[model samples]
Target: MEIRKATEKDVREITTIYNEGIEDRIATLETEVKTDKYVMEWLFQREKRYLVIVMEENSHIVGWASINPYSHRCAYRGVGELSIYIKREYRGKGLGQNLLLALEKNGQQNEFYKFVLFTFSFNDLGQGLYRKMGYRKVGVFEKQGIRDGEHVDVMIMEKLLG
Candidate 1:
């Protein structure tokens, strides 16, 4: 597999993978499937520090990762929010690790001092991956968001970067 910066051409696959995450109801709080146009703006219509990357194997995108602004306030400029999505069939095969490592490297290059992410409280697999990657579990937000008509708890994880 090859990991590289994401370009416009990869948006379709990226959107698909993200939709899979939504459909699975495991990774994000978003419930609606996204369109390519929406994904394009999201992936490209951001500052240089906010970056998106993709992993490809056999010329197909299997996963993606990105670093987003944690807050618009200047005080939080050094903090980046993390997002990672792997195709359903590709989950748990070490793909997220590769993407995350790349994102962390990119984050450091772009002046990010730390990275934070929120995941479903019941997402054991995702929590395991984050913990294995050196991210510490901070705490859980009760009833953070609604998923499938029920309030769900969300866990916050973070890692300080060099």
Candidate 2:
């Protein structure tokens, strides 16, 4: 497998993997599936400090990760919010770990000092991957988001690149 920076051409696969995560209802709070145009706009609108990466095998993108602005405030410029998604068939095969590593590396190169992510409290697999990657649990937000007509707790995790 090869891990590298993501480009516009990879949007289709990225969208597929992201939709899979949304459909699984474990990786993200977003319920609506993303369209290619939406994803493209999201990708191109990011500042230079924000980075997106993808993991591919045999010419197919299996997973993707991105670092986004944690906040618009200047004081939080060094902090980045994290997003990661692996195709359902690729989950638990260590692809997420590799993707995150690449994302962190690129983040650091772009001057990011810390990375934070939010995951559903019951997402044991995702939590395990984050913990194994040296991210620490900050805390849980009770009823943070609504998924499937029910409120679900969200856990925040962070890692300092320094």
| RMSD (Å) per prediction | 0.7, 0.9
Candidate 2 residues 11-43, lDDT tens each?
999989999988988888788899999989988
Q: Which stretches of candidate 2 lie over 4 Å from their true place?
A: none
TM-score of 2: 0.96
Candidate 1 lDDT: 0.94
- 69 in model 1: Cα distance from truth in Å? 0.9
Instruction: State the lDDT of candidate 1 residue by residue for 123-162, as single tens digits.
Output: 9998899999999999999999999999999999999998
Against the true structure, candidate 1 reaches a TM-score of: 0.98
Clash totals in order: 0, 0
